[model samples]
Target: MQKIAIIDYNMGNLHSVERAVSHAAAGNATVAITSDPDMILKADRVVFPGQGAARDCMRELETRGMAEVVREVIQTKPFLGICMGMQVLMQHSEENGGIECLGLYEGNVRYFGTVHQDIGVRLKIPQMGWNQVWQQMEHPLWKGIPDGARFYFVHSYYVEPQTPDLIAGSTEYGISYASAIARDNVFAIQAHPEKSADDGLKLLGNFVAWQP
Candidate 1:
């Protein structure tokens, strides 16, 4: 049984992630609502879920002393980041007055700009709705999942991985964005698989059964 850890650093949507993992039937899993580095270091897999500003997330991560632990997790274990969780993995975020991030990936989180509002109705900034992601790469985490699958998404800023190969899937808002990413032991999805229906469950299940 893989010991999956759903990191809880006072971000958003922790319980739903846990429920989704349970729905995937992972034999061994725990939701670490604490900031303990040892728990994360010991876990076989880690899921970083967030629903807020990139800067705030970074602040909390640092406040809880999980920043270094997160960096260490990406260095060793299989990691998955959801929404803003995906944003923080990058080098920096241009949110809440520009903040530095974990730098696990080379890109930064930026606003969609003039074409989109920071927050509001109709093509909103937060992007609070369901969107489809087209699979772009072949990886174990996406195993058995077909292309053009709809996943729940809610964010103002989206990710743009440094290279094309790191992109596992993509979704379009005012523009097409990197909806998912994978590199080595790091795996991240801009969409909330926990709320994405059957395809989402399959994706989570694949993660549970994934090796390397």
Candidate 2:
């Protein structure tokens, strides 16, 4: 059976993530929420899930000695980063003045400001609902999920990857922005698949079965 580690840094309610992933795995894998670097490194796949502030997330990761562990595992493991997990993979974030992230990908997370608008309606910050994701690149994580599928999202921030080719998916609030990124064995998404219903569940199931 596969061993999956959901790296815990006390950022968000991991219970939902755990339940969703567990439902997806369906007893075929052993899913664990662990902060121990050794256990994370030993897992067949590692999931990084987070919410709340980037500064707090980064601080926890660095202080707990998990930051370097994440950097090390990225090169070899099948890694999945969700929400703040995905944001931290970037070089920086414009949240809380400015935050330095894990820098796995060269990008910056920016807040959705008042300048954003769509169809004469002022787009809201936090974007607290569903938006359609357009596939930006072919990747394992997109398997069985149709292009332009709607995923649940709740964030005031978004990512802009320096390398365009690293983008796996895009979504438009006021402008087109990356919602997912992929490279090598790493795939990270800004939206929460756990709250996304059917398509969300399908995506999680794909991750559970993905060979890449």
Candidate 3:
């Protein structure tokens, strides 16, 4: 049984994610939904999930003494970030007056802006519900998942990775954004895998069996 720590940053859906991992790992996995640094460092695998503004999430992480802990996890262990969790890995974000982030990845978060706003097509800014993701490349993190599988997404901001090959999959929302990424020990996703049904479970299962 893998010790998967589902980080409780107070900004993401934590419980369901833990459950999904438990099912995927097929073992007596432990899920700790806490901001405690010690618990995070002790875990075999760390999962960072988010569902809010990037700036606020960073603020909470810093306040909870998780900033340094997360930095260490990504530096030394297999780490996964989701949604705003992925955005926080970048050098900075333009979410609220341009705040600095964890600097794990060399890129900035950007919005859809007026590209779709003025066209009157009115594609939802948050990009909610299920969407198919085309596999940009092969990644061990996506072992059992097929190419162009549908996953659930709900976010207004998206990642534009400087290392494009780090991107494992992409989803279209007027424009394409990196929906899944894998860079050495670090893995991230813009979609909520825990909510994507069987496909999501398979993705989690792959992550559980993946090697850093």
Among these predicted structures, which one has the highest lDDT?
A: 2
lDDT of 1 by residue, 1-212 (tens): 55778888898978888889877855555444445678778988888888887767888999999888888888887788888888888887778878888888888677776336544425656787788899888889778777887888877777767778878888888777888988888889988899989988998888877778
For candidate 2, write residues 1-212 as lDDT tens digits.
99999999888878899899999889999889999999999999988999999999999998899999999998998888999989999999999999988888888998887335333556777888899999988877788899999999989999999989999999988888999999888988999999999888888888888887
lDDT (C-alpha, whole model) for all candidates: 0.81, 0.89, 0.83
The best candidate in terms of TM-score? 2
- Candidate 2 has its poorest 10 consecutive residues by lDDT at 114-123
Global Cα lDDT for candidate 1? 0.81
Return the clash pairs for model 1, or none. 126-155
Evaluated at residue 199, the lDDT of candidate 3 is: 86
TM-score to native of every candidate shown = 0.91, 0.95, 0.93
RMSD of each: 2.7, 1.9, 1.8
Across 10-127, the per-residue lDDT of candidate 3 in tens digits comes to 8876888888888888875766677778888989889999888877898899998888899998988888887887888888777787889998888878776644764556677778
For candidate 3, report its TM-score: 0.93
Candidate 1 regions off by >4 Å?
26-33, 114-122
Q: In candidate 3, which residue pairs clash? A: none
